[model samples]
Target: MHGTVFPPIEPSEVISTFFFIVLLFGSFMTVVIANRFIPAVINVSFVKGYSVICLFIAIWEMISFSELVNPVLLPPASRVASMLVFLWSIGFLQSQIYATLYKLAYAFSLALASGVTLGVMISYYSNVFSFIESFATAARVIPAPAWLALSILWFGIGSASAIFIIWLGCFFPIFLNTVAGVAKVEPVQVETIKTFGGDKWDVLLDVVLPTAYHHILTGSRIGLGIGWITVVTAELASPDAGGGLGWMIMDSRVLLDITSVLCGVSAIGFLGVVTDSLLNSLEELVQTWG
Candidate 1:
């Protein structure tokens, strides 16, 4: 019942398991904490709103399993928690997560650089914009699995191919957004800068980019999400995929380990949500004009 329930998880990892559990609920729980602790809280009504949803989920799950829903397909939350605790102790959690994050980081960086450049070109050049609009439509429409196949063929079955597929998934939206952000730069701002003798490059640096930074950040945020989606696709088609979270989930499915699958899914989802929220917060913080 301790940490031993997971892939060699042990009792030594119980604290980490508890911390992770706290973290999983922390954002919503912050409402409860603040309402009870903070004085002069005006929006306290919304503070505990998410907690109701959480409680409802817990009750629903309880009733679901009590009504004889197969535990194998939908493992009890208690069992899932226990398994996570076990895995926490065995270093299983760290290794698998690190694997997925490593791949995603590589893909994200590539997407940021390539997407921004392509977006800037498309935004500024009418012909390029028209040409890329079609490409963006097609890329978004194409199933990721198809890209997985093409990536494998083009780059072979490893991180490089995985990174390519991830980039493909995220690239178009980011590029499009970058173009929009750049285009949204105010004409007056540009005119004013020019009247003051600012050059084109000066306008881009001081005005265009600053104005577009929020949109660019939004694109990057969305791109990060797409990168998360592509990891699953990459693992399935990847030649060298086996140890990471995606591969682990695939392996768990193959072996019919529902608890491990749940853990993997939870970790993947948790990381994505946390990262996106951080980026969103940063975007708000850095937004100067708005």
Candidate 2:
């Protein structure tokens, strides 16, 4: 009887794997050394957050080593990390990330521009809003993902479809927030501007936009979060997303490569965290400006 044969690993792969192993071990050691020197490090919010991550990794490692669950279903964290490193080394991961970000950027930019414009029009001209309100309400009632089928039909199974889905997901929150912000501006402020010889431009520049800026940003942040989720969903469903983390996950799943799937998931999580942090910083900056 012939036993199953495995492909020979390349020397470069061996070197890369060894390097990643050393990095992982060095990271763990650094954490341990830091813990020894700074017992109160965990008291800091950032450190506490990382501690939770470490705890999760520790639990996952234990579960993998203990074989309490099928390894195929839940691969070890090390394997996932190594897979991520290997993919990055091959430049495949970077291309996927770029594709996803490019689609997201186009979608969210369109949503922001149109949402804010329509929101302003709606806020200023109640008649226009009255005409559009019912339709808007009906559309908003439907979830973003529900539009996937129609998006694919309309735009076909490519990045266009994914962009449409993300735009749909991001538009409503931004529109609603802009309307709410504009509406919240006191009528007295508008009157005051007009009474002081201010034109419509003055009302818009001095009162409306400044008042609504924070709300718009808040809505943008919410919309962006939704966009990320929608983009991933679209990529998973639409085969012609070109390439993306979502596509990577789907491909890995089909091949039963759980480690690559986890790597994709980790990439998404890392991107989410980074983007949210940047948005938070922007929000704070706006607050300070105000």
Candidate 3:
């Protein structure tokens, strides 16, 4: 009963969620239309012609699997819609989304801070960068679940473990990107700045650093993504955090709750898409400046 309240299956609420989802998707379509379709119609560029294609996919998912999917194993889209509608009516929709976001926030904050600081230092100082880069490479190659156990040992079984897992999971991409960005700064730009009485920070600010902004941003974005992935595992491994999306997923699986599983999957994917889009916007801004 507490489980029902804790990680409720509100696939019913997804019906109302259409207001948010469809409107957002419509905005994306508007862009595709503006960027690709409109120009092509004016004989400027080739149209993507894929929005309608995706719509067709929705149609096929509803029709093709409606009766084919067993209720226990794979609920119909209609059922998932019903569950969404149910959840939305109770006002638990936003909370459901928040559950996942909470874990991500804890994980990303640490990884970004560590990665950027270390990356900048390494980029400017070759010796320091080599040592840090070597360690980051080792950490990245290690299995994430193993680190979750280690984190639990160090930080208990709740947010601490989850945060540590996420931190370790995302550290590599950000660190590597930062180092690469620092190392790849244009030599001529550094010289140009140096010739103008620029000190280390001035050269970095005016010349060397700007060149690597794109790479740095890319690393940070990837780190955020990996952190999300790691939190799911961490939550499962940590007994006390039996309230996160990962735990919610673990519980749903125990009860054979396919719709809830799908719901969690959808929510995570939604967040990921939103996050990537925001990062891309930042990257574009950096490029404009760079």
Candidate 4:
């Protein structure tokens, strides 16, 4: 099957694969060594975390080389890694990454702004919460993919449609967390603010936001993760919106290009880790502010 699917691996391919392995483990060993000597080298957690990753890659290569699975279905780690390098070299990866991130940024921004705003309003106003709570609950029960057709219909198969779907996926988690955050703010603190001749705005600014910063950041992280997943789904469904990593995956699937599919999937996974790490850093920073 491998022979029929991919041309026979040439000598250059073997050499390339050999160097890819050396580079991969060389980088890992470098980091591991640095972690041993450098106190400032990425904390113990990252070092330990990456060790597990390296182990997984080693296991993956073993299984692939042993032909434990069909190579066509589960390509070798080396091939996938090389494919990633190849895609990046050709600029395809960057363009698709930009497209996906572009849609994600717009959708996530909208979700953050509107979610925080409405969440604050609902938390403060019983009437507003009463009116919207049921509707939000109902909408939240529906999966993000269910909105694909409707979004495309409303926005017409383009970036707008993709953005709307991502926003929908992101909004509820953020809104709920924000409301919870505000609700958790102590009545004593609020009352104290009022006793000090503070108005509602002063209470909101001084007591509510500061108390809710942690929760809001938590929500943003969760929403960003959901937004990332939703953006891929949106792009997969809205091919007319132009190129994106998800679109690239679906397109590759059509051509039975498993390597390309893996490349896209790997890119998404890498980006997810990077974004989550960044948000985690922000969350930690926000905790310090408290």
- Root-mean-square deviation of every model: 5.0, 3.6, 5.6, 2.8
The true-versus-predicted C-alpha distance at residue 122 of model 1, in Å, is: 3.2
Rank order (by TM-score, best first): 4, 2, 1, 3
Where in model 2 is the C-alpha error above 4 Å? 1-43
**Model 2, TM vs. native:** 0.88
In order of appearance, the predictions have TM-scores of 0.79, 0.88, 0.77, 0.91
Off by over 4 Å in 1: 1-34, 39-50, 64-67, 127-137, 237-239, 288-290
Query: Cα lDDT of model 1 overall?
Result: 0.73
Model 4, span 1-290: residue lDDT tens: 54567623211333244575677689888888888888585678877888888888878877777799987788788888777777787788999999999988888989999999999998888674587888989999897878899888898877888888889999999999999899899999999999999999999899999988888888999899889888888778768865799999988888778878888999999899898898899888877877
Candidate with best lDDT: 4
Error of 3 at 282 (Å): 1.5
Which stretches in model 4 have alpha-carbon errors above 4 Å?
1-3, 7-15
Error of 1 at 23 (Å): 14
Better of 2 and 3 by TM-score: 2
What residue pairs are clashing in model 1? Answer: 3-9, 3-86, 9-86, 157-239
lDDT of 1 by residue, 151-205 (tens): 7678866677787777777777777788889888888998999999999889878
lDDT of 2 by residue, 181-268 (tens): 9988999999999999999999998999999999999999999999998999888987787679999889877777777788899999
